[model samples]
Target: MKKSILVVEDQSSQRKIMVEALQKAGYVIFQAGDVQQAIDLINQQKPDVLVADMHLPNGDGGDVIREARQLPGAPVAVVAVSIDLAILNQNLTATYQADAYLSKPFHPRELLKIVEELVGVSH
Candidate 1:
């Protein structure tokens, strides 16, 4: 089966861009605009990968990441995205148990590459 991904971003434009790129790459994609929606989707979808923005509407992406980890069958990979370089520089993988981190304003190719690396997707 095709791998599935959950993208949790508060910005509609950013979220659309990610969803489109991932969809084009042939992965099933689910999206959420806030922590609540992200958690809901995480529970319902149980995606293979998670791409979340650090800052969200109701809460931070860390909350979503933690939720995913607690699921019975959590996502295989979790990537945290943020505009704040400080957050990216920190060891978030240790704190949140994320698989990777991406700074915002990055090219779609960068996002694709990271997801591919995490999920072992070719192309």
Candidate 2:
């Protein structure tokens, strides 16, 4: 089966870019502009992984992960993306339990590599 991913980002351009890149990498993709939309998709589809921006319109991505963790199967892995690495890295490993972190404006190669690694897809 094709691995699936949900991408949550408040920025439309960034979201579109990510969606295109991941889709090119062969992931079945879903998108949301905020945490609430992400949660709704998670509850409905349960994608294999989630790539979410740290700051969102309605809520933080970490909160979305917390809620997702409570659901059956949850996400196979979660990646938190943020521009403010200094702020987001603080206690993130303990607090959010995220599988990985990607800084904003990152290269598509780096992001896709992480996604492939998490979903066990051979490059």
CA lDDT scores, all candidates in order: 0.90, 0.84
- Top lDDT hit: 1
Q: How many residue pairs clash in each candidate at the backbone level?
A: 0, 0
- State candidate 2's TM-score: 0.92
Inter-residue clash pairs, candidate 1: none
Candidate 1, residues 10-56: lDDT per residue as tens digits? 99999999999999999999999999999999989898999999999
The numbered model that scores best in TM-score is 1
Question: For candidate 2, lDDT tens digit of each residue in 1-123?
Answer: 888899989999999989999999888999999888999998888888888888888788888888667777534588889998784768776878788889888987888989988878753
Clashing pairs in 2: none
* Candidate 1 displacement at residue 12 in angstroms: 0.4
The TM-score of predicted model 1 comes to 0.95
Clashes of 2: 0
